[model samples]
Target: MRNGKTIEEKIFKILTGVACYSLIAILGYIIFIIFRKGFSYLTIEMITQLPTGGYYYGGEGGVLNAIAGSLYIAGGATLIALILGVPAALYINSHLIRHKKTQNTVRYILDSLWGIPSIVYGAFGFTLMIWLGMSASLMAGIITVAFLITPIVIRSFDEVLSTIPKGLHEASLALGSTRSQTAFKVLLKQGFSGLITAVLLAFGRGIGDAASVLFTAGYTDLIPTNLDEPAATLPLSIFFQLSSPIPAVRERAYAAAAILTIIVLIISLSARFFAKRYSKSNLK
Candidate 1:
């Protein structure tokens, strides 16, 4: 019996290690390919200048418009998600704390929403745009992306808040603090790092999701100055560039992909740093 148990444990451990290493290898391969193909073409001109006339056909231009548009839409969407998600998460962890059934139901619904395909969100946003007499513009994209990421924000923050000791809640209430105050002041502080991670994750998702923004954010060559103007994103830029027959255009697509990858990497790193720092501070 002891020998059998040891063998079983060893097998599972080996399997887990294999799985972990496989994922890391795959990720390393992807990063290697993107950079190897893109580094040569990713020039200062590509990053700084707007696409020139006939730019898609190996013209002199950059993807600055796409970069700026992506930042604007993702940043706006993230801000909106943060504003809405934080309060909702706080409410769930505070008011609904005692009601396990209700809390679970809400979380299940959020998880379902999060799992829904981004294309579905695009279709829904398109429908909503027509009904509201809105065109495909930056505002439309921001709104659509916000809707897509809100559930993620809420669920991520809720999970964090849930992990906190219930004694903190009880203690705050015992000290004569209102539920609202306790939820915001005590719980929000405890879960601050998680909140940052959730927002950055949503931002990364919003920026990288071409499907969700394809219908809502109409393509544009120039950077949009207003919310009502059409915007371009890096994912769309890469898609369009890759579709071109020109080899240079294809190379540019890889470069755009590299840029997108780097942005997400930065967001991920920042999240880890902030989360770790704040977690330590909270502990202290």
Candidate 2:
């Protein structure tokens, strides 16, 4: 019996290690490929200048418009998601804390939404845009991406808030504090790191998702100055460029992919740093 148990443990441990290393190896290979193919083409000109008339045909222009547009759309979407998600998450963990069934139902629905394909959101956004007599533009993309990521924000924050001790809530109420006060003053502070992490995760998702913005963003070569103007994004830029028959254009697609990967890496690192800092501060 003892020997069997030891063999089982060893097998599981080996499997887990294999799985972990496999993921790491895959990620490393992806990064390697992107940089290896893109580093030569990822010039300052590509970062600074807008696409020339023949840019897609291996012309002398950069993807600055796409970069700026991606930032604008993702930033706006994240802001909207944060505004809506935080309150919903707080309500679930605070106001509905006692109603396990309701909380589970809400979370299940959110999880289902999260599993839906980005392309579906894009299609729905396109339909809604036509219904509202709105053209595909930065505003439409922002709204669509916001809808895609809000469930993620709510669920991530709710999971963090749920980990908190219920005793704290009871104690606060016992001390004559209102539920609202306890939620904002105590729970919010305790879960600050998680909130930041959730927001950053949602931002990363919004920025990287091409399918969700494909129809709604309506690509343009120029940076959009208004919400009503069409926008370009890195993912879409990569998609279009990679589809080109020109070898140069294909290489530039890899470069664009590299840029997108770097942005996501930055967001991920920022999340970790902020989460750690706030967690330590909360401890102090």
Candidate 3:
């Protein structure tokens, strides 16, 4: 039996190592290709200047419009997701804890929503836009992306809050604190770092998604100055550029992918830094 267990352990270890190395190899390859092709075409003007007339035909222009529009959509969506997700998570944990059936049902629904494809959300947003008589614009994109990430935020925050011991809740209430007070002051404090993580995760999801915004945020050359105007996004921008017949235009696509990758990397690093600092302070 001992020998059999040893064999199983060795097998598992080998599989785990293989999986880990496979993932790293794939990630490294992607980064290498993006940087190698992208760096050659990358220029300060490519990021700072807006696309000029006939820009896709190897013309002098940049992706400023896509960058600004992506930020606007992602920022707006993250704000909306935070506003909705936190309250929903709090409600599930603080208000509905005793109602196991209801809580489970809510969780099941959220999990199901989370599994739904981004393209479905995009299609839904398109139909909703038609119903509301609104044009494809930044606001539409924001709303769609917000819906896309709301379930993710709520589920992540819920998981974090679930890790807090029940004893803490009982003790807070035992000390004559009202439920609402305990929830806001005690639970929120304990889960603050996790809340930040949830928000960042949702923000990353919102910013990275392409299918959800494809129909809603109509492509445009100009930076959107209002809610009604069409906006471009980095994913779509890369998609368009990469599809170009010209080699230089295709190279610009790699540059756009590199910029998007950098933005996501920065956000991820910042999240880790803030989470670590908050964790330390909480420990103290």
Could you give candidate 1's per-residue lDDT for residues 43-75 as a string of tens digits? 988889899998999988999999999999999
Query: lDDT per residue, candidate 3, 1-284, as tens digits?
Result: 99999999999999999999999999999999988887888999989999999899999899999999999999999899989988899878777878989999999999999999999999999999999999999999999999999999999889877767778888888999987777788788888988888888788778788999999999999999999899999989999999999998999999999899888888788778766766665622
Candidate achieving higher TM-score, 1 or 3: 1
- Which regions of candidate 1 fall more than 4 Å away from where they truly are? 1-23
* Residue pair clashes in candidate 1: none
For candidate 2, write residues 1-284 as lDDT tens digits. 99999999999999999999999999999889988888877888878999999999898899999999999999999999989998898889888899999999999999999999999999999999999999999999999999999999999888888988898888888999987888888888888899999999999999999998999999999999999999999999999999999999998898888888889999999988876776566632
Q: Weakest 10 consecutive residues, lDDT, candidate 2? A: 275-284
Candidate 2, residue 8: Cα displacement in angstroms equals 10
Once superposed on the true structure, which residue ranges of model 3 sit more than 4 Å away at CA? 1-20, 175-177
lDDT, each prediction? 0.92, 0.91, 0.89
Q: List the residue pairs that clash in candidate 2.
A: none
